[model samples]
Target: MMVPEERRNADAERGEMPVVQGIPIGAPQGGMAMVAFTTLSPEEQVVLNYRLAVMCFAFLDFLTTLLNVLTAVMGTGYYWWELLLLIFLLGPLSGLLGAKHLHQSLTAVYVGFCVLKTIAQIVFAVYFFWLWHILFAFLQIWITKIVFTFCRCLSRIPLERRAQLLDLKEVELRMVYW
Candidate 1:
């Protein structure tokens, strides 16, 4: 009898091949499967990059929100409103819209938000009297830059390799269909 590894290798070699009894490998079935891929097209790579950017934005928003809340509790009160707006409104809203549209526009929105937030942090740091708040603001800005750099690196990866990295089969299917 063939071992499981041997079976998997055979399945992998079958090029646009079928696996299991009913499901064909690389067939796009919509929903989450659409995002699943063992190989990605250029367009899919763009989509993946945008998704990563959105995640980065969310992370930065969360960090800023926490900092703002802590500062407000400690009597600083300088950035509470801005941080609340970003955490409760802007970040979540943009993320929801991005998930709905799954378009490149979301990436642009995320990048714009990051830039704005970074600028806001720097300005707030200069004006704020509380040392802790200023330090947290600076840290948030640095974290945002790191996240942006990481996303840029991800965006630069070759499409074929990204597909392999993401292990996306659905994208391959979409390509076949196209």
Candidate 2:
């Protein structure tokens, strides 16, 4: 077995963070600003993955809202009421607020709103025979799933870890969510 000093030197040469039991104990040598991926706990990994998915969904939601506004302005489709709803309850803003504060209640409210919004979209699709509405409904469902999954995984991580994740400074204390 290699001695501790030799192991440290080898790891340093390889540009790897020093870790113990899969958790990073300190910053990498030479002042590297990246933590090894293996240093994250399983729950953190899940949260990270879900957070990315949620962001993508949020982008899609924004795109759909934009398209609706364009169509309404052009007088091709009367989406005035729908536009009002989207503007009032923009999913991404609520999600970002909840995530930044780590407030489970706000996130839960967001999930509830998403669920209701999805149901309304489905009903509108069926009643109005709008194929595009169906697609948007499906997107909303996916967004809801991603946000719910992220929130569940976030809840599993300790408050201290979550605080560290929000630091956004040093690699050792930062998470990839932002």
Candidate 3:
């Protein structure tokens, strides 16, 4: 669907979602589904972008930890409890909470949890002297920056507008690799 630029702008100003034009969306290679990126205001776009970044990083961390655990089980004969914790904390927990935060309202609890998790990860990384831990700590910090930006953008939006922005059922990725 295509909307004229002038009409889209007018609809946005009137608190209506405008179907964005010219953005192509297709599933990635190997049949991985991609989200459609449209019907969003610029502010919503910014928030969703940050949300997706956090999700991607968290997913990567989960995969890395899972791989580590698998390798340990196959070679070292046992996986550490720490690896389990990382998988649980960074995988489903972070992703679910991130989705909630983005699709709903920004709550203090989620922000606090993110901050505490980041601090703990960094501290543990330093204590353990693990390169991967340190790398993840850096990624956590990057996620924090995105969260901060998301919070700022969300705060500037009025309550009525906020609801509309947060009501998106599926987050649209601005860039889709076909």
Candidate 4:
């Protein structure tokens, strides 16, 4: 039994979701499941790109942690809590909030991530600058730059949104004339 071509095309034109049965999507084409970026609306593309970039940041943090673990195995380095903080804070928050579309909560979490990241960078740089591993110190510098970039992105939300996120109410204005 075959579905008619006209029916399928009409369904697509009417914006109906394709119904699937008995199975789910599997390993993706072109190493990704997503369609071409150009196929997405501009807004959707921006959101997707933002999420992907954050995930990549999280992945890099994990790789850094793995490097540290291996170095520790060789008795040359020890694990650091800062890497865990970076991994947990950078990627997952954006991905989760983006999916939920919780506008108010997003702003608050963004601000919190910014503050914590700033503190982490400050402490890491100040405490580790004198260490012998120049590569590690330089990596911290790069991470600080990355955190600042994220903060800048987060801060670009409208002022009204920030105020709303903070639960600030708008006051009514009244004019009195003599």
Report the number of the highest-lDDT candidate: 2
- Candidate 3: tens digits of C-alpha lDDT, residues 19-118: 5542334445665444365455666667656666655654565566577667766776655764564444444355546545553342333455567769
Worst 10 residues of 3 by lDDT: 169-178
TM-score of each: 0.40, 0.58, 0.46, 0.30
lDDT of 1 by residue, 26-134 (tens): 5437533332224444544455555555565565575666666676656765555645544444653564354334433443455566677677777877887578768
Model 4: per-residue Cα lDDT over 58-160, one tens digit each: 4555465466556554574445743453454443355345323424344345445545545665676677765644455565556445444444444455545
Candidates 1 and 2: which is better by TM-score? 2
> By summed lDDT, which 10 consecutive residues of candidate 1 come out lowest?
19-28
> 20, model 1: CA deviation in Å?
33
Q: Model 2 over residues 1-178: C-alpha lDDT tens digits? A: 9976688788977889454545443454675534443357777777655654655555555566577666666675565565574563466556656655665556666677677778888898888888898887787777777788878888788878777665523453444332
Q: Candidate 3: list runs displaced more than 4 Å.
A: 1-42, 54-107, 166-178
Each model's total of backbone clashes: 5, 0, 0, 0
Best by TM-score: 2
Q: Candidate 2 — which pairs collide?
A: none
